[model samples]
Target chain A: MHIPDNFLSSPVWASLDALAVPAVAVVSRKAQKSTDSNRLPLLGVMGAFVFAAQMINFPVGMGTSGHLVGGTLLACLLGPWAGALVVTAILVIQALVFQDGGVLALGANVINMALMGVLCGYLPALALFRTRWKWYGVFLGGTCSVLASGILALAELALSGIRMPVALLEASLGLFAVNAILEGAITVSVLRAIERLNPSAVREEVVRSGRATWSKVIAALAGVSVVLTAAGVLVASTLPDGLEQVANKLGMPFGKHPAFRSPISGYQINSLGGAWFSRAAAGLLGLFLIYVVCALGGHLLGRMRRSYL
Target chain B: MRYIFREGNTQDGVIQQLDARVKLVLLIAFILSIALLARPSAVQLAVCLCVLAAIAAAARLAVIQVLRRALLVVPFVGFFSLVVFLSGDGQRAWSILAKSYLSALTVAIVISTTAFPRLVAAARFFRVPAFLVEVMQLIYRYLFVLAAEARVMQTAFAARGGSTGRRALEASAGIIAVLFSRSYEKAAMVYQAMCGRGFSGTLSRAEWRPLRVSDIAILSAGLLLATVVHFISI
Candidate 1:
């Protein structure tokens, strides 16, 4: 999910960086006001924990391996604001220090993996946990969060001008689906173990329930506004993304070459009238995607907190 | 590896002499310049290479150490660069590959020459908040401890004959759980310890001076070169 440098346009990348600022600001304010001093250290430790978790990859089919995005888990353990902060920090450090992801792609990577992954997975989990069917919520929360995150991740790749064949998307999604289910199982097992070992510790340590109810909605709206504004600006302008425009100017569009055209090429809804509307719609949908998925991530985290609390 | 981040051994010669701020600005400019170089001319590449060499020399970083650390990056960049040619850009593709390598190399050089603590201090001087600076500090400290824990997990898994296939997955999962729980517990202990010692939200720093005029002059020179090249390429 960590998109590397060199593949994306500067505008798109810059736009993501711009979008991150407000969400970060909102979250930072929420975290500070909560006065949960315990949560601060948790942010640092959880960053390390997620960093470590990322290193231990499980075998996926076709001789490749996948690791946990853990966005949802972080959101569940911490609230969304802190969770986003923690995940973003981990991603930045991993890229800059560990050389794991591309530097330019950090913006998209955080937007997709951290923001989208945490919220989407959290929302459903919280809703489900409130019901009698805890396990069902766990399964659905984990699955949908991953599903949404995967879709958004794929879109990011596409927007960066890397064409994914339909077959490839299907295969990748299928693999991720398996990965998410197993991850879900692991999440459930870990939660159960933690519950058994020290229920009180989980209750005392986690910070999800503290998230103000109004924040959930505000974050969603803010995230959507950012995505739409960014996409609308890009679509309206004549400039292509940094890499794509560069490729075109160089007469070498790489993945944009005919052989690599995707079914959803351009991120535009062609059926819509006017280029602006099409792009605006795409931007709106993209933001919607990030909001829904990330909100779910927060939801899942909230549910976990309630269970222990 | 051990020398890269140990404290108080500021015997790194010229690198230690330069203001940390100067190094930070130059490193960032270097990365941006390289990234923006669409298809670098050989002259452009030569200019960058020469500057890199000069910086390396000034920092007194051993060529061997730089090369050793830089080699780990070869596999990652090598595989992707090879694909660049296959994308049908011909000569232009080769140029892109070279530019990317030099950019990555520039990043490597900056990190290698500067000590981590100084780098963090530099970041602070750059106005990165105290909270984030401390967070970065703690993460680095905990990384070693976590690595040791990871090693122990591997050893225990091997001893239990849990070294293959399904067992491997389970072992990995178990290790993750353990690390999560242990880190949480340790964090609680750390918070308690800090509280006992009157821990506040902000971490205090010892006295340090700002960048001197000479440091500013050097950074300005680097920036000037970058700006010239940027407009020329444009």
Candidate 2:
């Protein structure tokens, strides 16, 4: 889901843009480091291939057809960093040339699709590479990539003071689920077909055996993040006040502290003046805080282990 | 001759004649200002839209065409707005819809006015990564070629017969796989061609021309106007 401009509040879009630029830069650096020469045109052509992949339709038994989203496919073909880079490029082209998304919302789009989507897609497949359930990994990766990004998009909308009705929220989630399943199925089948046509074309990293411990950890972490993201969306949007009450009851001095004394301190941006401004603010801060803590801990532990070894 | 995306690059106009860097800074600053507007009623939104329309006219673009083209953002923004409206928050829904429309229109006008390459140059000048910009250049250059090939393949599939159930799935995969290998081969050829022609990982370009005094004046004037409108709306 490419979000348009003005869909996100100023703080929401601005912070996301802040998050995305660094993330994209780091991923771009990783991609560049992996390639000796600037094999940029190859990545660019693969990006075009992805755009083209969207044109061809895969029929899914109900007389309906679905096109490839290509996030997982690109991740499997190129490495994750390059895959994310390619998707980021596609989002840029879409925003500027195709008018498919908004320039202001570019950061949110990049975060949801390019970074999270690729990481989710890659982790599952990487985890299951040596197993008989390798195809299952591929399938799950495709599904998770779409689902993670879709849910994150929903959360972002919620954070922007979009009060989705229960029925509408459930319907959007259901649609995401269906699309995720279709993406998973498509990725698996396409992966199998590639192996059949040219065994050598698949990257050696996926083919060769790697340490399963790290993969499993990453895969589990990814799974947890997706679940947390979903829960975060629900809490932030629906039970935002309830959450605020809990924070208050826990003696959280959010307002008095000068550091925490920002515009959105009460989980509401005073300037925006939306009814649910506080609702979204509470959700983003509280739910996303948990995610940040967990993610940072895991990253530190991994670094420690790597350094010691 | 003009295309929707590559149009203003080949044409001449008042906005198009302004240096791309100036246009880039001004437009982005204006969009950010539009986003940061505290509360937008009919007057504020109308003013934003009118300003964009005036820019389109100044650029000699078809004003109606630019306005209508920007409506492409409507369906996506409309759905969420509908949700907010249903939940009985009318103001937030309207605010989002209007602001997003203004932002999209601003982008549409700028892109339709400036060449994509020149815009990229401006982005680079602002310190965007070189590698990322290069990839964008290649993708834009060849997006149509591969997309056309995919269209042809889909047509051939339809011409023979579109299958349902199982066979269709495998056929689709086969098509993607073929496209993948073909793209891979083409990339190899492109890299070789670039190398043969002394492309050492960077596309050659003339050095940036010094910004004209007029460009600076236009930029400052635009920024001041946007800031005024923004504060007035608030």
Candidate 3:
């Protein structure tokens, strides 16, 4: 999603812009290394192709349609570095020429869609394609890329301190999930068609055979998820505090009266005096409980599946 | 499909006369100032708009054209603002809409006054990589060509009684694949043509012109005004 200007707070956009400058530089350097004299024209033509392709929308059921984001597709065709560079150029043109995104938020847009989207899509596809499931990798890459972009966008919105409801966040995630599936299907179809017509056009880097240690990768991913969960709980615990700060800034009365106090109001035991320790204790306990339940469920399911097998 | 290009150079105006480099700098400063604004007041938004309008008038552009182009950002930003509104942040939602509109208007004014080629050249002046700038220039040039080809393909598809459905999506995918192949071949040919003309790796350009005193004066005045407007809280 193109983050329009003003949606992001000043600090958020400024830091993103700062991060994006070096990212663009690194991507440009990598792209230059991979390409030769033909690189400039090819990049240009590829960009034009993407621009033109986006104009032709495809139906996505229910009389609604979605255009190709092209980040994943480009990365699949060109290498990821070149792909990111092309997408960056497209974002620039979109911002300057079409005003599709905000000028000031251009860096955030680039970081979200161009850099992160390509790498997320490309890395997974690369790892997957190394195995026997090449097509599956392509599909997964496309879907994951879109999902990652959507998640990043959500994270940005939350970090902006908008204090959106949980339902809205879920709705956005659900929407992106649908979009990701569509993107995956489209990416698969397009990649297969390219393979049939001109096999060489598909980058070799994507399909290079390498031994991927699945267990290690899964462990790493699991570790990341656990860390992320903990971080989310921590953020959730501090959310009301942030809300109160905003409320105070706006001169609105908040948290003075009990708004239907629960057993654990604001992530703390109400019996406890709403201290930091109580909130932290409640949050950590909740996290541990969730881990225990998940581990137990997984162990039981694995055992059941083994019995059936 | 119609393509929008730069306007006439014959129109002698203050903004039009400024060096592209100076204009680019001023554009960045203005956008930065607008972006830095948090919870901008009505007066602040008005001041920003007035500045944009003044620039538009100085460049002798049609107010209607600039506004119409600026309005294109509304639906995209408006959709998000609506989401924010639904989520119970009314003030932030309005701020997003207003700030984005002003930002878009400012960009429209800058782009409308400056030629795209000169803008690209100005990017080069800022030490933006030559390859990136070259690719951007080529992309801008070939965008129209590829767009027309895509239009023709769409027409042919429709002429054959192509209807929207899963099949249309597959057909569109195939069309895009074919377009990629065509563009690839075209790029090869374009590269060959460039090679035939004793071409170097870089896209060569004429010597850069030094900024004039008037350009510096204009830039200083614009930055001064922008700085004042930026720090004036509410």
Candidate 4:
């Protein structure tokens, strides 16, 4: 799911943006090192394939349609590094050209759909490849990748201090779970088709039997799961359980603290008494603020860097 | 697939006339300021909206286009916002919805005003890796070609009584596989073409233009405005 701007607080999106740059750099570097020639064109064509694939929506049951997110599929076909890079490029184009996600939130979007999605998908596929259930890796990878992305997005929103009821979070999770299954089925069908048509296209030297790599991949996947679980716990603990008192106990300053009181402080408009209107207004104000601040910061940073050079 | 080509309306207004680098800076500044604010006041939101409107007008962008593009993010964000509302934090839910729309609008303005090639050139100026930039350009160039192929394939499928269902999905998967193989061949041909023309490992860089004094002035003014908005309490 492409997170729109203003859904995430500045700290959330900013840190994600920071993390994504280096992650993408590393991916690009790895991808460059692996291929000898025509790498650029290869990535370009793959990216186009992804973009075009996303446009062709298929009818899932219940009169709903879903398109391929392509993270797992790309990783399966191109390996993880090149796969992530291609997805990142597609995301960039979607944001800048299609306005699919927020420009400022590009970092988070890339991290969610490109980096984490690829890793989650690729690692599982790698581990499963050694087993009798080799083909099942595609299905598992596709499902896991989407689920991981959804959880990460929720975790980010929680970390940003946006509290929603447990029910709401569960609802979102449920939706993603279903979407993940569909994605998994699609990935499997597509991969199988590719294999049947041209086995070499889906074949890679790395997927061949190697014990050491399998252990490492499994370990990495375990580590990611552990970290995600811990993050979920952290999010759960912070929910409105005497939040104000906890902040006070922690010596966190609260209430009318800043010189500039946000027009909508605490997600409530002061003058408006109705809960919905105040909340909506507060939401609107929070969004506007984020849009202004991130845009400004990115601009100043770009300018300063240029001047310094 | 409705591909969004750059409008090339760089001759229309002050925003369009500004150097691509300067326009990028201004857009970033506006986006950064929005992101930095912990909670923007209603006044601040209004001010930002006004500023966006002013920029759109200056750039000669159609308001309807900007609005339509910005609305694309609503369903995604709106779903979560609805959940938040159901959970009783109506304020945060509304805030998410509003903020996402404004952010989308701000980005739309940037893309509409600046030509896509110039924007890509600006990214190159920022020292984004040459490989990444080259890949992006190639993807943009071939996106339409592949998309057209996909469209033709889908049309042919539908003509053969391919209604939406499980069978359609299976058929679509086959189409995708075929597309991947076709695109792979196309990539090889493209590499061959590049090689034929004395293909160096790197694509040729675009000509760089030094930032003019006027461009610097505009950037500074934009930054100054952002700073003023940031510090303003209301």
Calculate candidate 1's fnat.
Answer: 0.22
lDDT of each: 0.61, 0.77, 0.74, 0.75
Q: List the candidate 4 regions with Cα displacement exceeding 4 Å.
A: A205-211, A218-223, A234-309, B1-12, B90-92, B231-234
Cα displacement (Å) at residue A225, model 2: 3.5
For all candidates, state DockQ relative to the true structure: 0.30, 0.51, 0.27, 0.38
> TM-score order of candidates, best first?
2, 4, 3, 1
Question: After aligning candidate 4 to the native by TM-score, how far in Å is the CA of A79 from where it should be?
Answer: 1.6
| Model 4, span A1-309: residue lDDT tens | 777677776545655775676566667767776776887788889899988888787788788888888999988788777888888888888888887777777888888888888888877787777788977987898998898888877766665556667666677778999999989988889889988887887767337423456656675767497448635544553466534454466676763222123445555667867543455445446655654654565567658868998
- State which docking tier applies to candidate 1: acceptable
The true-versus-predicted C-alpha distance at residue A60 of model 2, in Å, is 2.6
Instruction: State the local distance difference test value for candidate 2.
Output: 0.77
For B144-220, candidate 2 gives per-residue lDDT tens digits of 89988988888898899877778988889889988888888899999998899998867875267888888888898
Give the alpha carbon lDDT tens digit for every residue of A222-275 in model 1. 545644543333332223354455456567646543223434355467887554
Candidate 1 or 4, higher DockQ?
Answer: 4
In candidate 1, position A244 carries an lDDT of: 57
Best by TM-score, which number? 2
Q: Which residue ranges in model 1 land beyond 4 Å of their true spot?
A: A57-65, A139-150, A162-182, A201-309, B1-11, B77-87, B90-96, B163-168, B205-208, B228-234
Q: What is the lDDT of residue B25 in candidate 4?
A: 70
Lowest summed-lDDT stretch of 10 residues in model 2 chain A? A254-263
- Any idea what lDDT model 4 has? 0.75
User: RMSDs, each prediction?
Assistant: 10.3, 6.1, 13.0, 7.2
**Decreasing lDDT order of the candidates:** 2, 4, 3, 1
